[model samples]
Target chain A: MTTEVLTTTGAPLLQVRDLQVTFTTPRGRVRAVDSLAFTVEAGRTLGIVGESGSGKSVTSLAVMGLHRDAEVGGSIALAGQELTALSEKELSRLRGRKMAMIFQDPLSSLHPYYTVGEQIAEHYRVHFRSGRAAARRRAVDMLGEVGIPEPARRAGEYPHQFSGGMRQRAMIAMALACEPELLIADEPTTALDVTVQAQILELIARLQQERGLGVVMITHDLGVVARVAHEVLVMYGGRAAEQAPVDALFADPAHPYTRGLLDSLPRLDDSDDEPLRAIPGSPPSLREPAPGCAFAPRCAQAAAGTAQDRARCADVRPALEPYRSPDRLVACHFAGVPADAAGRTPANVPVPGPATVRPQGTDPDQEVSR
Target chain B: MTTLKPAAGPAPAPADGSAPPLVSVRDLTMTFPGKRSATGRRGAPVRAVDGISFDLAAGETLGLVGESGCGKSTTGRMLVRLLEPTSGSITFDGRDVTHLSQGALRPLRRHLQMVFQDPHSSLNPRQTVARIISDPLLVQGWAAGDARRRAAELMDLVGLIPEHIDRYPHEFSGGQAQRIGIARSLATSPRLVVADEPVSALDVSVQAQIVNLMERLRRELGLAYVFIAHDLSVVKRVSDRVAVMYLGRIVEIGDKKSLYEDPQHPYTRALLSAVPLPDPAAERRRERITLLGDPPSPAAPPPGCSFHPRCPKAQPLCKTERPALTVAAAGPATREVACHFPGD
Candidate 1:
């Protein structure tokens, strides 16, 4: 069973085992990713969802073998190849060839002077050992695949000439140009307006289906996760608080922190009456080694005799275990609610609607309950 | 010629038979001088804000929604004469203050205030909350003795402790610093406040708290607001009416529900469809209207309708003619759209 879980049809697309990423700054040593472990099966999407400072980016960076000033521990295997053992030059060779990443902001990731075609072709040349003319032709074809109209004309225009959405499409095109086995997208659509955001989501979805690629999407948004992710990993202060199938995680979150995050999100169809329940307190700073559970400071479930509970959460460090079914794994001390809990039925469970919708933008209605 | 008026203080026993809007912006147009490219030749002048017009009732909240570079922020700054408009007029209390000189606008500044996006950058680094809030009152020449009292009241109104007034801005959280900024904006008793992305920098929970306070203050003080933001969902929640802008033009303007539930303009519909729904079931069912390309450069917008290149309903006429802002066939006073084909 362990072998079957670890390897699918011989080798999993990407395997992360006790991956730890730490950064040393003037302030102190920050453990950005804390003993995190997860796997992304081929032709599937695994979402790592957390708020700012939750170490989502650090984890993805560690997977790409990209963090410069950080100490990395544990093993990341791609198609059974251990990436940590590879030399810098070897890793560089594998970067665009086997793995690719798309950043949140296209404007920052893309060079202003180069045309979209040139940048995509540059990545292709670095990996494929193809002729420049052949690379440019491939770049234009990839651009068309990402839904950019008039790829031929657009290939000649510089990055500055493209709008926010178009630039994002160009970024996706570059990532796909290499035909990598795995793709890492870090909030790739956060900076875009929703209309463009939806298009990008669809584009990624369609490409992933067509390519049979494993995708690791990192975002702070739960909504995006619900739409695209097949499996979910809920992280808090660098640790995976809970992991399960997308529907199962939302239907019945095992961890208190996961429960809190789910409650905080404003539902789109919410009626204008329910008062929003904001998660109390803030995420703890990770400047030093944590004493107990990192979520204890903000968690409401902690009690005086919780020192016993602390032993399990803080000292023991709960491992992921099957909760509902054999497939669903949750890493919480209290993996599932007791059978007699009052809020089990749909009538009692809070169905989020518009009234409790929390505003996510810079618009002024921040406080209006409606 | 209808004149705009500054939001008056509690009416003095009903002297005037009727009250007009606090700030009336009639066909306001703002054009900025764009720099020439490396070719040493001038490019088309950028219309940061084109002929856009709106009225701010004495105490109503008007939300301006658009993507970045759509000129909502420029429009906010122009309302208070921060950026001088090339044409049209902004009347404050029946006075045309659009082209008012800096010196002449200073006194009028007491009645209009702004809350900027970055609290840390907006607040003076060295100044304490007391000083920050008191600066506006002091600039209006309030006596030093009375300034502290008014500042304390403003701080308490925004839920900041009066005792912490002497603490510097760096000592506070993002939410706290924003409260300090809000305290300062209200210190002068400004009737109209232009808040540009006030809560975008804070956490979800903290954002809720700050937004709630703003709503409470709006009701209690009966102050008007020209709220500018990119988040349409939040705009729909708080605004009585929302105006959608694209390439320096108001593509659609309607009451919150109508604009959101039944957006007439194709651009407005596309914008609404972009917002991701939280529910797994609902999200899967919703048909998203995706725009194909990036918005055209505002500097050299498409010749006909600025949005024609990316607009889904664009026709031959749309490619050659700029559509005028007019009432939609749906015929709601709050529902006016500028489009060749306004689809609900």
Candidate 2:
């Protein structure tokens, strides 16, 4: 893979620092994203993964300058240009040309009344000021580039006329029409089936290879991150819980939240009948987060720790810093604890049954009495 | 927990055997009207679920997995009597309930329940959680005090705090709302639950919690589940047997181990290969079988085998002769597939 080579060779195309997004609601001020930071280099993918209310989508929206009413703070830069300092007019000019975004539901994101070609051409014409005919031709070319069959005829159809996968392809064609340097895809394949998801992911990876585009793929599926992302950022309670290379994050996750997520996932290859280790509590409320670690209340390690360790967890928040490995960053106080030492239950280890009972995996013996 | 176990009796026979299944369908089919054809005449009907048959045993999960529009949801609705089947017979516990009138179905409704996909829309926002969970009991003629007590117990069984029973659906998160939905489905202590894409709309972590809860309930209550989902991994976790559907037909049906490990149908193989595993090493090393094009529309399906267009192992016979599901040469003797060439 050229991902490792491309990641270390050049400056990051997108850098976010101390980003915070808060929305004023009727109940109170909701801090959706708090002090989140990450960088994405050209020709590489940075996958942001979390459950609902984890601020992954909010961070993407903040980078795209799409939040009109919410209060956004901190720094966001694109190719040496500070996005936070740019005016609305300047940001609009840079949106489709320099950076673009694709949403999860293509049907809702796309205009229902307009032809698919007209939408794509309009997106291209806005930035290039090209003739209508030229833009239309580019639209057809882009539709073909995304592997949509019969591009010329399909381009004339409305969003409703196309299938789910084709609509997503048209959405991608529109996003890439202007040749943006950065692409922020928020759950691009989350709405599609597994087969279509694989196709869309392959298309994105191929396009990124050809254009060296920086990609920020936001999704909740860790399998997707393992397949496509160069680096991964795990979020919890509107903050970054852990960040590491894709392989490292999967092989040995440092934070308890990440570990719980991995253990909870039911693997297709695994055929064991053991119960899944579900995370005990739901996600925290972002409006009034815990004073210390956001995940401390639900974390198994924090519950089993000594009084001093528990006090530190409840009183002082831990900062995201390097743990053991320089490339891997974790926000947990006991990040380096071994799995068994942290009271993590080993999965798929069979326990002995009652003396009179037969083993679980084998067929029940008819001779055994009740 | 030990007292919860039933008497140690002989293992139940396969639902496909001569013994009657808890829920049985013979030649089930459903079709919807479509637009006119190019000849300006009435077009062919859209075959949502065309001539499919399967069975659900007591205390067993039968996973129906397919892509969107494959008619899995339509089949689920038919089993629960929510939709009138175009043509077929549904035998429940030796009684034919296919075309029963609404008045006659009232008594049978207590034995079957359904859980929908979108928790937000499935639940009524105006109603309180207590009212939602107790509605089934109320419909069944339970007293008000008894129904409320049952609803509270159901809430605790599904891991929801009892104090939040009075709150409306809008107050809970997606996961909590799904728990409420589960509680409502179990309010009648139904024998069969047809969950149509229940956890697909939830987050991955919350999805695990719901799956675990459903598994535990099945064990404790001895409830049979018709688990329908597009996620193969999730289906594998919950299903004892699985039936893979494509273009409104069953392409393969077998035990979970046989179907996943040695899929006989080319479509099943492609679908399994497309799923991304969380292991980076395995993902990088595995070879993928990408199908050529999108599924053909059900209204205008191909002449012979519907999967011929995208099948990698398609032959000339596949274009002219429709295959029938039969015992496969490989795997278990009970395993069945509708492919001419059953194995790689």
Candidate 3:
């Protein structure tokens, strides 16, 4: 694909450094995003995964320059332009022309009254400065490109007229209408069904390859990361816990939070009898930043912190450093699978099928075992 | 996924071994009136759920799964008489209960209940846990003091602390709120409870807690559930027999093991393939069947099978004639599928 070649030849499509986002709620200033940084290369998909309120969405919003009434500190460079240095008017011009985003709920993203084609055409004309006829034609072409059937007729229908999956397809078509270089998808398929969700993920991956677009796919689902992402950044308590190639991260996740996240999801192959390793506690709040490792409270394998290792985690934050592999970087004082455990698949393999006999109301099996 | 050995002994046949099913649905259809055109005339009606049939044996849990606007939710609502059906019959213990007037259905209402998806929203924001659980008992005309005691028992049965009774819905977590919702549904000791995506709205950690709690309650209370959800993994875990839904029809129905290990319908295969496997090695190698199109609009469904537009193995027969649910040649006695071209 042209995107893969472009990523290999040129610079990363977008580069972020030391990004920080803070919000002032009624209670106090909340450090929602703390020193977060990552890069999205052309044709490459960078997955940002974390639970709710873990700053995954906030970081994405910061990249899009969409957050309001919040203080942002750090550098966000698109291609060769520094977005943090751009004025609001300059950023506005860059939004649809250079970058676009797709949200979780397409129902709210698209204007209901306007036909899908009209909205896409409006974006086309506004950003591309094409004539009405040309823009309308482009809208239909884009819809067809996104795999929507009967695009000519379907494009004229309002958002409410389309089904959930169709509306999402339309939203994808609109996001690609402008052919933006960077596509920030925030839980784009969370509201979709498994089959439809897979289609959407494939659609995004296919489009990224065909259009040579860099994608920042945000989600709370690791299954998606395993299949679609070229690179992944596991975030916890507003910080990047681990970042590595998809294969590397899955093979040996260096951070405790990443391991915990992977263990929490129920596997399809697990036999109907094995118990799921559900992460016991929820993600920690960032209101009062932890003195030590943010995950220490929930980390089952928290290493013994003497005066040295524990001091940096509490007061001086650790830098994102290369862990065992050169490509994989983790921001933790203690990172890496113990030397002996290296090259071995964790016994925690989720056996396929139904999980083990769970106490009622605890497993999805409750509905079947009546 | 875990393997399920058949429950001990011959799976108990019907309550009292009666020939009549505990719940019977015949030719059930529902249509929602569409909006009026610009001329103030009604537009075409939307056939949300076309004619369908099924039976629920006493103590059995039937699972319904499908995408949005596929009428899965509508079907659940109709079973409990929450929404009026445009056509068909719903018989409870051989008694025709469909079309009963609100005043007349009150007595039957005590036997059937529903648990909604979002515990936070399903519960009253202003009412305390005690009041919420007592509402159903009070509706049944139970004495105030007796209702309070029953509510407390139900709360404890659901694993909530006694101190939680005085607290409002806002005070509890998502899982706790769901426990309260379950407690309220059990207030009247209903025979069947239609829980619609009960755990889909919560976190993964919390989902297990709620599912386990529901299972224990069922064992202890002898309550049955019509579990509705889009998550097949969760459904397969809970249901004894599973019903695979597409558009507005049941594509496949079978015992839990048969449905999970050897799904009969192409749609079921696709749905199963789409489920994410937690194990990286297995996930990388599993065969995936990608479906083609979105679910068709119910208002004007396709000429024949609603799933034809997206079915990978769709044939001419699928487009020309609707399929009927029939016992599969290689399936268990309880297994049935409504597809001309079923299987991967």
Candidate 4:
């Protein structure tokens, strides 16, 4: 199933397993991400979709070795090299060269005083130990590569001088300056307008194609997921609700939370005659230890299920396991059960739209063969 | 414009476009004085809402959509009289309320209310949900007991547990806090509600819940709405007619069906195309009209069309002469587009 594909001489670009991130807050210990697992192969984009406080950003920060105060556990490997075992010094060496992340806000992510060009040049010099002249040239080249017109003039301008879209493009240029093998973008286009968002998404798609980079796009927008992701990992209540190929995830979501999310979206192409089947309750709080399933309280299927089914959901924490097919994993008690016996909402989420409207971005062969 | 407080009129004749509109706005404009320089020289005044006119039939939702700083929010505020317009007329229920003083505007406020974006920030964190919802009713001379009871009912109306009326805003989730905001907006049973990006801050699942609730309330209460948001899909779901604004002017206005399927204005086409569809195959098949650059600042908007700088179909005449919002020359007669080459 896995080739260590795309660019030659790679041992699985990025692999994460049993990843757990916890924080010591004033209130108490908060488990931001719990028992989440996913992999990103070279030339393929892995989308991490979740709501606010679902630990999407936490997972990205952990991958980039940026979580200093938080307690991070479990294995995070890049090209078969263990990252959790690495020290601060070693991790710093790997950060910009091995992996880089772009944040939602470009203005704050960048320094206000420094020229955009200088920041990119400095980042390049830190990672590659290049001199001023060479790093400067590299920064301009990256700026031009990212489709920034008049790169020479724009590079000298400060972040505040650039518009929102231009600032984001500059941020992308800075992220790709060293040509990192892996890129983790956390809501990269959330702050920009829809027009600008499309341009940035297109730019990212083109750059990924040209460089064959392993990309992890974290966002709350399902439309972006449908457009860019080869595979999707849906996070809920600090846990992986479901993980599957983009088409399967959208077409036939196995987890109740996943189904609720898909049904909840008011699509542009679809008619809005029927009331959206919104998930009934708010997101779960991570303060307490969840002995049973994290989503049992809000899962509509469990609510409509039998006493035995409800008890199983509330008493046992369902493990992330293969459902129907090994490639599609679902964390739910009633995943593979018959539709009529179990509630119909969970397993039968696909509205006969999968085959006819399958997104074209989930071609694994192209990613592998390129 | 100081007419006696007339009786709260009967629920406006069901829209049908035949009856007089519940709200009629013409040539509305707001000019916010620019910030002063270090030398104390004031900059050019920002014309936030340029000359824009529209009619909102009773019980109909007119969605206002545009990018940030495009004046959709400004237009919404003007409708509610939160920000007084520098020039133009605003007639509500056949009465001119454009320049009504705060004292004179108080009675009319019961018929018009606004739901702001960022529910948490808009709501007072210190106040309990009961007090928050009942404040409007109390101001309108309802007895204390009656106002509080109505507050509880409003909470239940918006799907919140009435028993938890004493809970503070922080105790609730993002979705629940927004429900309180909605409850507060509907407190006085306003006939027209101007919601400014009500669901943008909410998660997708919760956004759906709120949208459905709002739709139901509008239907059951015979309410009209001016839904202002940046999200096209949500607006499409809730609106009967939609107006697209760019740089302080509405570039396009039409029925939701006509606007979505066949956008006439170049900027509208680009904006609609920019909204990524959830369907992947459709995304692959459709062509996107990517605007060349960002929208020009309203402080110094382009001379002719505000969109001329980035417009793909802009001509020499477009650069020199401003295009007025007029009926499209071709295609759907159901729309008014402000472009030199609409439906080209």
Residue range A1-370, candidate 3, lDDT tens digits:
3345445646678999999998999999998998887889887899898876679999988988988788889999887578988778999998877889999999998998899999999999999899999999999999999888899999899998887778888988998888788999999999988888988888898898788888998987788777778899988889888999988888788886777666655455556574445444445658777766776644534423333333454555667898887888898766764423222243432222221222344322112100
Best by DockQ: 4
- Arranged by lDDT with the best first, the candidates are 2, 4, 3, 1
Runs in model 1 lying further than 4 Å from the true structure: A1-9, A112-115, A254-256, A288-290, A300-323, A326-370, B1-19
Q: Give fnat (model 1).
A: 0.34
lDDT for each residue of candidate 1 in A37-70, tens digit (9 for 90 to 100): 8899878999998876788899999899999899
Error of 1 at B257 (Å): 1.9
User: After aligning candidate 1 to the native by TM-score, how far in Å is the CA of B309 from where it should be?
Assistant: 2.7
Two-way TM-score contest, 2 vs 4, winner: 4
Q: Candidates sorted by TM-score, descending order?
A: 4, 2, 1, 3
lDDT of 2: 0.86
State which docking tier applies to candidate 4: acceptable
Relative to the real complex, the DockQ score for model 3 comes to 0.31
Model 4 over residues A1-370: C-alpha lDDT tens digits? 1233323555679999999999999998999999988899988999999987788999999998889899999999988889999999999988887788898999988999899999999999999899999999999999999888999899899998898998889989999888787999999999999999999999999999888888999999989998899999998889888999988887788888888787888877867789877776666677875577877766766655665666677789999999878889998988845434444545533332211122332211011000
* TM-score quality measure for candidate 1: 0.87
True contacts kept of 3: 0.33
CAPRI quality of model 2: acceptable
TM-score per candidate, in order? 0.87, 0.91, 0.85, 0.92
| Whole-model Cα lDDT of every candidate shown, in order | 0.78, 0.86, 0.78, 0.85
Interface RMSD of each: 7.2, 10.4, 7.2, 12.3
Better model by lDDT, 3 or 4? Answer: 4
How far off is residue B305 in model 3, in Å? 2.5
